[model samples]
Target: MVAMTAAVGARPARAAPSAARLRAWGRGAVGAVILVAIILQAGAAPFVRGLAAVSVPSVVAALLLTAAATAAAAWRWRILAGRLGLALTWPQAVSAYYRSQFLNTVLPGGVVGDVHRAVSHGRSVSQVAQASRAVVAERTAGQVVQIGLAVMVLVALGMSAYAPAVGIVLLAVVVACAGVVVAAAVSTRARDVVHRELDAVRTAFGTVGTVAKVVVASLVVVAGHVATFVVACLAVGVDAPPQRLAAVALIAVLAASIPFNIGGWGPREGAAAWAFTSAGLGAATGLAASTAFGVLAMIAVAPGAAVAAASAFHRRRATRAAAVEESS
Candidate 1:
């Protein structure tokens, strides 16, 4: 009876993790399906051509733009961290941000990088919770600003065929959020976390001029990404009007924000293909452009890989030195 009871109690615990694993696999599978569908629809020629089309000038431009964006993003993150009592210097934030970008580019789920950076930073500050919150707040703020800018771009020059659909989706989101707020008010656990997040956002934006500074930083990041995408499109010979191309590029960037992606591949490419097609550009052209953009993105973050290696080396060396000191 004792053994049976123990097994029965352990079943629920095991089931929870099993369910979580199942969901993760499901998400990955969806991402894979997206890529496979794109490949089936567009063929591999565009992708190969895209890789071939990358030139030295384009690579240099991408690197410079990426650096500028990384700096701005790091500044935004530092501002949020400062307000959260998890302050770190701008240089530290930039290195950590680069590390996160590299990891996100190479890893599945697209957010493993951010989580790693947050935990490591948290540990450094001896305030893991605050540091974690700062990261979350920073990411959340970036996404919000990006979406806001997307809406501005799209509305100003939208040839989008599904404007009504997008509006409906936004409306639905607002309603769902309201429902969540109501539900959280009645739920002890949900209320606490929701309130905590709300407080964190308020604190992060509380200071005079902080909001303007953050918005500027976010704009610089957005401009860099959009400009890089444009360069990719140009490299692939997409001859659409400047405004329309910018709109399509912004959409592609927003799609990259989707979490269910394989190293930031699936949604971005898929959306670009569709958006370009809608904009009267060939679907293959969009695929090629997005593919080129992805490659440039990887190249731009290559420094982060070096940073990760050096940081690991120093950490191991420090551990050994400490061991020796203790022994003596």
Candidate 2:
């Protein structure tokens, strides 16, 4: 029985890399190229110096806000899970989220964390698929919020003084995204498919209290991200206004979502620098803020180290117990 169980569990674990894996690898390569481009454009010395000179208070503030941001993320996940009928406690969701974030930073593709979350909940394949779709929806909502916030911040900061060319480019992106969303939503087949799955859809949407609560929480999450960036700015002595914080925050979030540069190191910093420069701020300041934020985030993730250790120990003990049982 034990041998059979082991066989069923193990199978032949050959590495069958899929098309998706190949694409992810390609994206990683593109990310590396982006890093090289940023390095060439920005010059290496100023970047390094900017990262090195961050102060203590900024670090503290960034860490605090980072924790809040992580909590907000867990809250979002909880809402999604509840919608899917797989309810997890806040503490459980938060711990698992932190571990997932750690994995995204340390492991390849980052999608593995999604798989981990799905399997950890002991969900069926269809449930996992629905849950994964909801995660993507949540992410889309956050990005929409980020873009809106960035635009508002730009207007508020009077960064409109920059070349009209940039504004045109931004307008084009907005139009393109709007068009894509509209096209998808307006398709009768698409609407029918979505309506057909109303049960799952309603369940997913119902997890959170109301749309207003979700919106409010999303705002708080965005605010937390901006606060973290502002703290990083203070640490690095950037002296920018609260409005400018949105640029850095938006860029950081967008770049980090792209799978590359071990925990978002290269792209995050580079994109931040570009965002700052476009906002009429020095690239050094953006680089500094990005570096400080990254450092504080890594520190915030330290608890996940303990969680990982505990999980490993539990697995080992379970294995040993199974061995004893099999022998008996």
Best by lDDT: 1
lDDT of each residue in 13-103, candidate 2, tens digit only: 2221233344445555666677678778767775666567555766666667767877887787777666666667888777877776675
lDDT of 1: 0.78
lDDT: worst 10-residue window of model 2: 1-10
Give per-residue CA lDDT, model 1, range 1-328, as digits (tens): 1111112212343343344334434555677789888999889998998898799999999999999999999999999899888869977899999998997788765766776676678768876667767777777667678888877767777555635434643675587679768878899977876787679779989976888889889899989999999999888888878998888898788788776677778988988887887888878888999999999989988888987888899899999999999999
In candidate 1, how many clashes are counted? 0
Question: Weakest 10 consecutive residues, lDDT, candidate 1?
Answer: 1-10
For candidate 1, the TM-score is: 0.87
Candidate 2 TM-score, C-alpha based:
0.75
Evaluated at residue 34, the lDDT of candidate 1 is 90
lDDT of each: 0.78, 0.61
lDDT of 1 at 260: 69
